[model samples]
Target: MTTFDRREEGFENKFAHDEEMKFKAEARRNKLLGLWVAEKLGSSGEAASDYAKTVVATDVDGGEAGVIRKVIADLAAKDVAITEAQIRVRMDELMPQAIAQVNAGT
Candidate 1:
């Protein structure tokens, strides 16, 4: 392949890798968010883990918004009070930790 073609291929590969990392980070963030919400709802052990998994699954189609909606509805059902802004802020805060965890292969 020509140098230009090789460079293009490299760029494509980098883009794919970056996208994968972003997905992993977001999924991790969702899991963390779910666990936090679960704690607020008084879930522990296996129940908390299952709840976190559901949050991750929600992201498959709904992305962040769906997860937020699900958590908000759940918290409200349990009489826990939290605002959308607070959930968004927590998502932002968890992102870095999620990214670090993803990079570390944990």
Candidate 2:
């Protein structure tokens, strides 16, 4: 392949990977926020967990990232010590299951 073609292929690959990474990262952030809110609300056991799931789904559907971050930051400001990265990881872990449960409930 010509050098230009090879460079173009590499750029395309990088772009695709970056997009995928962004999607995964956003999912994780949402899930992490859900978990934090569930804990903050003191939800526990099966019944309480169902309630928490509902809350998380609601927040996610609203599509208000600023609100979510504000809440997270507020909690941290009060000493929760949560960073954005931590939120992302937690959210990624829980968002998929949360989405599934929500879809089933609907």
Candidate 3:
């Protein structure tokens, strides 16, 4: 293979890996957010964890909007009284931590 071909392949591989990491990070952030909300909703231990996993399992059509929209509606239904701004803020706050956690996994 030519050097140019090798470089192209390497770039593709790096892009794929970066995308995977982004997905993992987003999922982790969703899980963390879910746990926070679950605790506020009075769930704990296994129940809280399960709830968080469900949050993480939500399908993302484009970006975090799917997760955030679901969470906002769920919270409203439970009368938890949170705002979209708050959720977005929390998500922004947790992204780096989630990324680090996901990247550091065994």
TM-score of each: 0.99, 0.47, 0.91
The digit string of per-residue lDDT tens for model 3 on 1-106 reads 9999999999999999999998888888988999998887889999999988878877455357777888888898899999999999998999899999998992
Candidate 1 on 2-58: residue-level lDDT in tens?
999999999999999999999999999999999999999999999999999999999
Tell me which residue pairs clash in candidate 1: none
Model 1 TM-score, 2 decimals = 0.99
The segments of candidate 3 whose C-alpha lies over 4 angstroms from its true place after superposition are 60-63
Candidate number achieving the greatest TM-score relative to the actual structure: 1
Residues 17-93, candidate 2: write the lDDT tens digits.
87766555444445455556556655556644554455446555755465356557556655666667766666666
* Worst 10 contiguous positions by lDDT, candidate 2: 23-32
lDDT score, residue 46, model 1?
A: 100
In every candidate, how many clashes are there? Answer: 0, 5, 0
Error at 103, model 3, angstroms = 1.6
Segments in model 2 whose C-alpha atoms lie over 4 Å from true places:
45-106
lDDT of each: 0.97, 0.59, 0.87
lDDT of 3 at 11: 100
